[model samples]
Every structure is written in structure tokens, then in C-alpha cells.
Target chain A: MIELTVNGATHRVDVDPATPLLYVLRNELALNGAKFGCGMGQCGACTVLVDDRPVFSCLYPVSSTAGRRVRTVEGFGTPEKPGPLQQAFIDRQAVQCGYCIAGMIVRAQALLERVAHPTEQQIREHMNPNLCRCGTHMRILDAIRAVAATGELHRAGEKGPAS
Target chain B: MRWRRTGYVAGAVLLAGVIVFAAIAWQPAIPPVKSPDIAITPELVSKGRTVVALGDCAVCHSPEGHPAFSGGLGLRTPFGVIYTTNITPDVETGIGAWSLDAFMRAMRHGVSRDGHLLYPAFPYIHYTKVTDDDLRAAYAYLMTQPAVHAPAPRNDLPLPLRFRPALAVWNLLYLRPGAAPALDASPRERGRYLVEGLGHCSSCHTALGIIGGESGRYLGGGDVDGWHAPALDVLAHAPRPWTVEQLSAYLTTGLASEHGASAGPMRPVTDNLGDVPPEDVHAIATYLMTIQTSQPPTAPKAGAVADASQLARGHALFDGVCATCHGDGGPMETQLGRPPLAASSALQGPTPRNAIMMVLQGIPWPSHPKPTAYMPAFADNLTDDQIADLVVYLRSTTSQPPWPDVRDEVRRARKDLSHD
Candidate 1:
């Protein structure tokens, strides 16, 4: 059994040590925020924050994240009470097929945490590993920029701002 | 009066030394000739193409996004950056006016048409062994190419090296200008001629001294642009020993089932070799097999467990970043037939330099042939600490002992990346 602290909750999962974190997250825990797009790390649909760093949870082993903090899109907020970044995404309409949005949000959250105001170039470079086939990159960029301009993401983590 | 007489004697000795040096260093300029009116046959031109490919002339002479043989590539050396000269037959800047004899002299003696001493970076030491027939064919092919008027940038050498005559002394010590000895007409002999002469494999494969002269350890391991060119004589030491067929396949296609794909500097060489005839590559493989120095087989010892905290971080990084491509169940191994990381020579080697470089630089898309194996560079994505962790994790999986200084290796690789 591997103990994982995910989204402010602790769960002891009884599975093989080699099982991917994505499998455990969706199967045992039923937190389906992280989608499984490409089993390989090429596509970032399985992105999650391990110790505040974005990693491909699909390829990441659950055994390795034993003591680290794992945050998924669901950790940000629920559908009715979305986080600042999520609200910005909703306000900017940064959704197409929506398969890639969860990963995009999780990856962008990591960047926003590190850099309060990322330039367009920095955001583009940071988001390069994630592939969005729906052509909603401009909207996604706008959403991140909107949140950056408001500076609400910085305050959201310390004190949850009402949506 | 006694001190003045001693000064006069010292001055006289210095003057005599200067005169002797000048006598040995001076070379007369060859007269320029018009583009030869000789009718070159298509057969000769075709053969010349093969010869030029074998020589890998364009690899040094041409910079990327430039016309072939229109030289401007800067070769970084221990001395300094030496720019390659334009070999295209442009009358103004290149060898358009060079007569066959002038070209021959440059190839065999490291002297330019204007009597200037060419640097040994041009590999004339090895070219001196090339036969006259091959030289003529190469000259014919180069002259037929559309000339580009590009002059080379000045070399970035120190003050003493800036003096061209100094190379004359260096040549006297290192250069041996003559054709290689005649051998029986066999595939092995043909391979030897190609490898030793025009192929110039030793230029990179052989170790170098402080002055950049070959250290006489022919086909022994050497470094090229921070990547280790593994010793050619120790094929038997590989996890899956290389056979003639495997080497031939690797030479032409840049991929072997048992061994990893070629990356870094060897990629371009294999890309060039892909265009050559199969027989030439096969012969090279055939010849290389004969030169193998057998070693006592080492028992695969189990690696000792590493620090738990560091191992955990490394395992996490590997799972998140490296395992997608390198894992046993990874698509690269299952579908593309890439060997496991344990089989990689870079991991099994003495140092962590190549492994660090492989992660930092990865393999860029090939230009000549279609891309077979491509890995995105982690230099920008992963920090030095992360890379060190990944490398340590990889070494732990191997049968060999852990590398002593992985973090230092990563730092060195970062330095090389900055230079690039």
C-alpha cells in the first residue's frame, strides 16, 4: 500500500508500486480531474502539481509521490465555486472540446504560482509541452493574462476569495 | 668591454637561429591557373561525389543554412575557433584559380595556393595518405560545383598562433606527407584505406595531445564537442557485443536493435554515411570487426542502494520525465525497438559526461534522412539538480557502480550548453 497526500486529503492505495499516479487518482480515489489523453508524457492532459511542480501524472509513479503534495484541477475548486484562475478561464471562454482544459489549468496554475506576472513569451514557452488540438491557445493565454492583471491568484491560495 | 663582447656573441647566435628557421619555413607560391578546360567525364564526377562523401568535406566546410562547400563553419578547438575556408571554386574567395598541382600540394603538404601554411584542423595529416586518383576525382567534383563567393572569417587564435609561419614548425613535427602503402585488393584493404585515409575516422576517434596533434592511440576513445566518442577497439565490451551486421546497420541507418540510436556528433556522420553505397559501409564494419581488442568479461554486479531521500526524488523525476520514453513498458521500447537504458553505452561508460549531455541536448531532428528517433531537450525544462537526480537514478539501475560526480557533470554540461 502506497500513501499519497493528494488535494489536502490522505489516501492509502493498495496497488502495484509501478502503477501510474493517474491510474490511482482516477480509479481508487475517483478524482477524475486529470484526464488520460496520451499515455506518454508528450500530451499534458495528465498534468498535476507534485510539490508545486507540474509533472505528467500519467507517467509518474504513485510510489514516488509518497510524501509530496499532489494537486489536480479538482483541488483548485468545485464547479460552483471556482478558483480565481478557473473563473478567469471561464470569463475568457478558454474551452473548446474541454479535454485539454484541465491539464492546461493545472499547468498554468504551476506557472502562476512561480511567476506572479508571466509575459506572453514566458507563458507560451512554459505551455509548449502541453498540446491543445482545439486551437483555443489564444483564449487560454487571455485567461492567464486576465488573472495575472488582476493579481487574484496570489491572494486565492492564502485566503479563498468568493467567486 | 667584456659584457659588450658577450652581448655580441648572444646576438650572433640568435641571428643564425632566425636564418635557419626562415630557410625551413619559406614555401614558394604556386602560380594561379584558369578554370581547367579539360573535359571531365560524368563517370569521374560520379565517383568524385562518393569520394567527397567519404571524406565528409562538407561537414566541416559548410555551415548550416548555407550552400554546400561554401565554408564559414567555426570549429571550436583547444587553441581557439578556426573557421573553415570556402572550397567552392569562386575565383575571388575560393579555389577557382587553383591548379590541380596547387590543390594536391594543399591536400598533401598543408600549404595553401598562396604559400600560406594551413592549420592542421583541415586534417591534411590524414588526407596525405589519400591516393592521387581519389584527389583528382574530388577536385573534379568540387570544381564542377556552382561557386559561391564566401570568404572565411579570421581565426580566433592567440598572438603567437596568429603568425602563420609558426605552423611550418608544427607541420615538421607532425605531418608525414605521402600516399599510404599499396595493399592487396580486398574488401578489408579497401576498408582500411578508406578508414585511415579519406575517411579520417581517427580525427575524432583518436585522443589528442595539448597541441591538438593525434596522441597515437588510434581508434581509442576521445571527446568531441563534450560528447565521448567511445573507443572503436572495444566493441566486445558493449552489453550486447557488436557484430559486423550490427555495425553496418548502425553506420547506414543510425539505429541498432540491441544498441541505442546515434546522437550528438555521430548523428551527422551516420546521416552522411546513409547516402554512400552499402558495400562501403559493410566493408567498414567488416574491417572494424577484425580490430577488436577482447577483454575479460566483467560480472554484472548489483548496484548498492543510494540515499533514500535522493533516490525518492530521482525516482519521481524519472517517472514523471524520463520513464515515458525509457521505461520497460514505454512506447519507444515496445513499438520503436529502442534498447533499455541499461544497454546504453553512455550509462555503462566511466564518466557521466555523455549521459548528462544526452539529457541536456537530446537529439535534434536529422537533416539528411528521415527522423527515426527524436527526444526533446530537457535543458530548459529540467534544472541541474533534477538532471543529476535522473542520471543517478539511471546509473543505479545499471550493473556498474554509481558515478562519483554527477552534479559536477551536469554543471559542466550546462557550461557547454551556454557556449552553444
Candidate 2:
């Protein structure tokens, strides 16, 4: 049994420790926000935060995160009370088909946590791993900027319900 | 005995050395790509941009966030979903390292730089018709794009379809010979090349009938990813059949009079083809109008009639199995606003393979705002010969001009349908 805290909920999952965090989150924990695009660490659809650093969950083993805090798209907030990033996504219409939005948002969330005011180039470089098919990058960048303007990034250190 | 053993050891060593040497020599070299000697002028760039717009290479080949032409798009087909490969000039991942001749072979012949036959799913059959000049320009434009190093996922075709060698036979039968067959013969011919070659009309328009060669006719519909190829027939009775002007309008805007908006597979085609030069689009319309409507070129003349006894047997089988939808008023035209046999382009279109395929594999109900016709697959109920005769009977009665000897072709289509 491996005990891990995802989105604020502590859970025990029975699986091989060597299994990538993505499979454990998806198959055992029933969290599908982390997608399995290219299992070989090419596409970054399976991005998540481990102790506030972006990691490709598809390549990150569960054992490596034994005590590390894992945050996912679900960790953000519910639809009724979405996080600033989620609201920014909505305002900017950054979610076309919603397949890649979770990963993109997660990456952005991690970036904002590190750098409060990121330039467009920094955002592009940092968010390179999270791929979107519907040409939503410009809108996504706009959404990120909009969230930054709201001063959410500066106060990212404030804990919100352990998520 | 000791001498013999020594000889054997020496022989083994020699064999290993030869094998290693051969592998070193045969390391499938990627020939260097040479840009045309002509200077890159504003006019050249503008022309290349137009081609890019028409080709829409950026749409499928380049994912939204990826560098332009750094491909990773997932294209779903019936056989298996294939990912688009990177077209960038990256030496490690993209075609940046490909020779001009290699690129030409890949585009015109579907052979890759590694000397492997690419799957027809790549639509090289249509790209094969691209002129040397246009291909060079397109290559030049791609070369100028950013070099992105990202290898795409390989296609996962199921079972025998994965067998690459068999494609050679399929190519021999279906693929037209030679590159962009001299369009100088006529203006209409040039238009046909542009549409059929660059436009890739056959990829969607040609119905892959239950049989082989029997299904090569252009713009004869087939189901791909649940999207039916709407007949582009010029006949007055075709479903929302458009005049040349109307066709151009629809191709440009993805909408037309009486017809609903183009959706599904057609969306991409129109999205790309709409950007083509107005004159080119008009030329396509001209060529499309000239599609042989009376009959296919290979159809047998009336003089070589089928045996009367055989035809009689075919008639009886048709009545027993096919009379329900296709009988009495002789296959209702305008079934659910879709034209029936009386007004069908099928009667006037080339080849009976599509009709035969429909009978064997019954079309999936067309998806529209309003539900259209549904036909059930009949493989379980009918034999190959029975289906063939039924097809012949339909053509003899409804379609003008006799059909070609399609028995073997139908047999092949049936085999493929069975596996599919």
C-alpha cells in the first residue's frame, strides 16, 4: 500500500511502486486529468506538480513521490468555485474540447507559483511541454496573463484547503 | 581434423566481418536536400504561401502549440489511428536532412528516406500528382520553417494491414502511373491534376468498394470514419447537386444552396481547398464536370453479353434478396431528401463496385441534423457470386452502359470486407 495526498485528499492505492504516477492516479485513484499521450516522455499531457515543481507524471514513478505533495487539476477547485487560473481559462476561452486544458493549467499553475510575473517568452518556454491541438496557445497565454494581473501569482504561497 | 576446425573458425570470422561491413555500408543514407537554384523572390514566397494555404500543411502536420510543421497530430481512420510525422528540417527528428530526390520519391512514390513504402493513408497517391516545380517550392518553404526535433508515434494498423509489402500490389492496381501525367494536353486535364493530385479527391471521394479494381472510380462515395463521401457527381439529380458556380461557392465557404454546411471529413478539405486560387477552383469544376457519366471506360460492350441462363439466375437472386429497398418503383429516389435510384448518380457514375459494396456492407445511416437512410450489412446473408450478379443486374437495369468484368474484383472486395 502506497499512501499519497492528491488534491488535498489522502488516499492509499495498491499497485507496483515502480508504476508511473500517471497510471496510479488514473487507474487506482480514478483521476484522468493526467493523460497518457506518449508514454515515452515525449508529449507532456501527463504533467502534474510534485512539491510545487512541474513533472511529467507519465515518467515519474509513484515511489519517488512517497512523501511529496502531489497537486492535480482537481486540487484547484470545483466548477462552482474554480481557482483563479480556471476562471482565467474560462474568460479567455482557453479550453477547446478540454483534452489538454488540465495539463496546460497545471503547468501554468506551477509556473505562476515560481514566477509571479512571467513574460510571454518565459511562459512559452515554460509551457512547451503541455501541447494543445486546437491552436489555443495564444488564448492560453492570454488567460495566464489575465490571472497574473489579478495578483493570484504573488499570493500563490497562501495555502487554500491543502489543494 | 584440427585443420578443418581452424578453417571453420576463420570462415565464421570472415562472415562476421562482411556482415559488419555491409551494415556500415547500408546505413540508409539520408540524401541532402537541395533548394532550387532560382533566387527566393517575393513572388516565389507568395506562391509558396498560397500552396501552404491550399495544402493546409500547418493544420494537420503541426499541432497547435508545437513549432509549425513539427507534426504530432492524431488522424483516426478505420484501420487504425495514425499520428502525423514531423516535417521540420531537424536532422535528428524532421526531414531537414532529406535529399531533394528522397523528398521527391516520398511525395511522388510514397517511399520514405529509409527506403520503406509509406502507407497509402499518407495520401501520397494524390501528392504523387504534384508537379516538380510546385513540390520544390513547397520543399523550399518547409526548409525555411523552424527546425523542431520531435519524432511522432508510429501507426498501429491491425494484423495483415500492417504487412507493408502487400501495399505494392494495391499500388500497382489503384495508383496511377507516372508523376502528374502531362497536363499540357488540355486545360481541363491540368485542372484535374491539381484537384486529383494536390486536392486528393480520391482519398475521400473514391468509394473503397467491397471489391478491388472495381472501386477505383472518382467521387464515388465511401464511408470513412462514419463520414459518407457525398457524391460530387455533376448529374442534375445528385443530392443537392451544385452547378459549377455553386460547387465553387460550397468549396470556398463550406456551405451551399439547398445543401447543409460541410461537416466531418469534408470540413478539412473545404478548409484547405477554399484557399486555392479562384481560377484553379474553377479549373477543378471544369475537370469534375468531364467525369465519364455514361459508363466506365473498361465496361464491356453490349455485344459480349452475359449468358442468358446466368443473367436469369442473377434476376431471381435479386428479387429474393434485393427487392425490398431497390424494387417496385425501382429504388426510390429522394429517400429522406436523399435522391433514390431514379435520381441517383450511382446509375450514371462509373463502376458498379460502390453499389455492390453498399449491397454487401450496407451504408451506415448518414449523420445530419435530420436522420437519413440506413442500410444493413448483408455479408451474412449473401454469397460472393450472388452479390456480384445482383450488382450486375442493378447496373443492367438502372445504370446505362454495361459494367466491366467485375467478378474477380468483387471477390477481392468481399475478401477485404470480410476482414474489415
Candidate 3:
């Protein structure tokens, strides 16, 4: 049994230790935010936070995050009380198809926590690992910038009463 | 002993090559076929013009920004570029010296007046099937063009190219010079002949082989230059399935009431098609409608949230920016000439790419004087988010499937179009 602390909820997932963290989160815990796109580490659709650092869940083994704090889009915020970053995304209308947004928000959050004020270039470089095939890179960048300007980068994840 | 065996093998190969070369290079005795002696009447010239248009003569032969039929277009081939020859009746430099029999032989057998092998780039394989009556009329029309002094550009291909004997071998393998099978002399058969033969639609629409002959996939759609020539065979997938009437309108006037105005390489083809009789276009369309291309259905809407507010946002955005031009009885669509959005294939189609592209790129004036409609690019002015909302809203109004990840598409489309 693998113990996964996703969005502050402890769950014991009975799967292959080698199973992609994406499958465990989605199938075992019912977290549908991270997607299964290009199952290789190449696409960031399967991204989630491992101890507040962005990692591709598609490649990250379930066993690796046994003790690490894991967070999926569910922990980010609900639609009713969406975190500031999610609200910024709503304000910018950054989500399309929304298959890639969960990963994008998580990665952007990681960058904002470290840099606090990321230039357009820094944002682009930081988010380079994630790809939105539909070409929403510009809007995603704008959403991140909006979130940064409001200084709500850290607080967006604080709500929802500790998952 | 091994070296001796090798020498014998080499000598046998050399002997075979020599025999092949001799056979291919042998000149046939020219039969005295008289040129049509009757004076060219106005009727003959007009009929000949139709034949020329049917063949799309101006597109390949007439070099861009050059005089018509003076032929300096450089057609790319796998081996190298083959420059189109001057077809204008310049006595010294063009087909003026070619007798009627010689011209027919070239059209039928890929042979020149001098008994040299002509390249398949001339499309004689398809031209071989063109009726003699049409051929004669086409010639009568060409003979009327003013003989320009300009000579064709020299073909800058690798050595051992365009040599009479060598090309004959290439022809022997690839060229099946004969008339295409006609089940009956119906209008559909006539359309098939025109589409497959002198019109040589398949030459561009079908993929080419390594030897540079038509792969004969037959309307499977091939690329001409950079733009894609859509498939016409069972693989054809228009946003809205093409009906005979819509195809006829598109072929005759380059505009269909349903969707998509001709662009890129298709512009010249549609323009040329306008010169032909409407009945001819109708016949072509009749034959084309029989082709059934099955494409995979759109992605399921399982993951879609379908929130009412999300749709409302899109509807609001469309009303603000697009309603002025695309609204019901909007000035641009109703009065000016833009196609109606409700009947637009791009909006209702399985994919949002075309509609989104049209919105982002907009319609530009084609080189031809026809259509005269214009839709300016919104890539610079509209925010990606707004375009995403607009595309979704427009699609919803038309009852199209909700496209996922549209903001990314808008962003990428803007980048791609900016480069263009």
C-alpha cells in the first residue's frame, strides 16, 4: 500500500508502486484535474505539486510521493470560493478546453511562490515545460501576471479548510 | 575468377543499356498530317478558350507576373526543377514550328517534334485522354495568342536529364497513354473525362510517385506548393459535406452559399473553371458528390462542464465584437457580401480550426477580380481570451460542438498568422 497525501488528504492507494501518480490520483482518489496527455514526461497536462514543486504526474511514480505533500487541482479551490489565481484565470478567461489549465495553474503557482514578481520572459521560461497545444500560452501568461500583480499567489492555496 | 565474373556481368549490363538507349533514341518517320486549313472563326476561338480554361493552361504555363502563355514557370520535381516551355506561337521560340501531327504526338506520347522525349511534367498521360475535337479547338485558340519574343528559361537540372533516350525509358515505365474508360457517354462520364484528363485535376490532387508521375490515387488530394489541395475521392471531408449544388456554385463562381471561399492555389483553378459552361461545372459536381469520405467523429463531450454562465460569457463577447458584421442581417454579411454565419460550415463543423482561422486571418482579396469580398485580420486587435470566447459563442449560435482548449488555439493561430 502507498500512502499519498494529496491536497492534505491522506489516502492509501492499492496499485502498482510503479503506477503513474496521475492514474492513482484520478482513478483511486477521483482527482480528474491532471490529464493523461502524451503519457511521456513531455506534456505537462499531468502536472501536480509534489511538496509545492511542480512535477509531471505521468512520469512521477506513486511510490515517490509516499511522504511528500501532493496537491491536485481539487485542493486549489472550488468554483464557489476559487483561489485568487483561479479568479485571475477567470478574469483573463485563460481556460480553454480546460484540460491543460490545472497543470498550468499549479506550475504558475510554483513560479509565483519563488519569484514573487516574474517578468514576462521569466514566466515564459518557467512555464516552458508545460505546453498548451491549442495555443493559450499568451493568455496563461497574462493570468499569471494578473495573479502576481494582485499579490495573491500564496493565498490562493490556503482556503478550503485544509483538504 | 571472381573478377572475371564481375567483368562479364558489367559487360552484359552495358550491352543492355546500349540496346535500350538505341531503341528509345530511334526517331519515328514523321507522317505528313496537314494543319487545319480552314480559317479560324469566332466560334472556334471561343470553344478553344473554353478548352484552354478546362486544362487550366494559365496556372502552370503562365509564369507569375509574366505574359500569358509565354511559359517561364519553374515547376519543382524530385530530380530538379523543369522550366515550363513557351507555348505561345512564336515561330522561333514557341510551338509555332510544331505541326498538328507533332503537337498531337506530344500530347499523346510524350514525344516532341524533333522526336525528343518530353517530360511527364507536361501531363501528357492525362492529356492523352483529351478528345481530339477538344485538342484541336484548344490549339486553334493558342494559335491566336500574340507570339512573344521571350524564350523559355533554361532548365537547370542535374546532368543526364531531358535527354531524349533516357526520358523514354521513364515514360515506358510510368506512362499509360490511352483514353480513360467511359461506361457511357453520359454527362457524368463527360465530367469524369474533363476532371481526369485535360483538366488533369488528379495531377495536382493525387500524390506523385518517386519517378514524378501521378500516383493515380485519384482525388485523394495532394499539395500544390505549400497549400493543401483537399481530397476529392472517398477521403474528402468538408466541414459541411459537399452537395452537388454547392460544389457547382464553388466551381462556377468560386463561392458556395454554404462555406469556404477558394484561396491559395485553388483560386486559379476556380477562376479558370468560371470560363467553362455552367453545365460542365454541374456535371463535375454531380460526379464528385458520389465520393464518400468517412472522417472520425469529433471528440465526445464527456469531460465538458457545459456551465450556463460560461456559455453566457461567450455569447456576450460575440454580441459585442462579431455581431456588427456577423449578426442576423448584419451589414457586412447581408449588404456587403460576407457569407451568412448560420449557414457557415466553419462555425457548425466538427473542428473549430477553420472558423477560428477565418475569424483570426479574415478574408483577403484574391489576385483574381472575382468575389471582391474582404474580411480583415483580427489577430492584432483582439485579445486571445476574447477570441476564444468569440469562437465558442459563434460556434454555440451555430450549434457546433464545444471545442476544448480554444484559448491555446487562438494564441497559436495568432502566432502562425503573424509569421505569414
List candidate 2 segments past 4 Å from native. A1-163, B1-30, B33-42, B55-59, B63-67, B159-166, B181-187, B209-216, B292-420
lDDT of 1 by residue, A38-155 (tens): 7766678988888777877776667667677899999999889999888988998999899988899998888777666767777876787788899999999999888877665553
What order do candidates take by TM-score, descending?
1, 3, 2
**CA deviation > 4 Å runs, candidate 1:** A1-163, B1-12, B294-305, B369-371
Residue-wise lDDT of candidate 1 within B170-281, one digit each (tens)? 8888899998933977778878888888888888989888888888568987887878887788786676788988898888888877787888888778877888899988
Worst 10 residues of 2 chain B by lDDT: B364-373
Can you write out model 3's per-residue Cα lDDT over A97-122, one digit (the tens) per residue? 88889899988887776665767767
lDDT of 3 by residue, B291-397 (tens): 55566343445225446765776666555445645667766467534467755655655445566676655664454566544554444334566577667767666
Which candidate gets the maximum lDDT versus the true structure?
A: 1
Each predicted complex: what DockQ? 0.13, 0.01, 0.01
Give the Å error, residue B228, model 3. Answer: 1.8
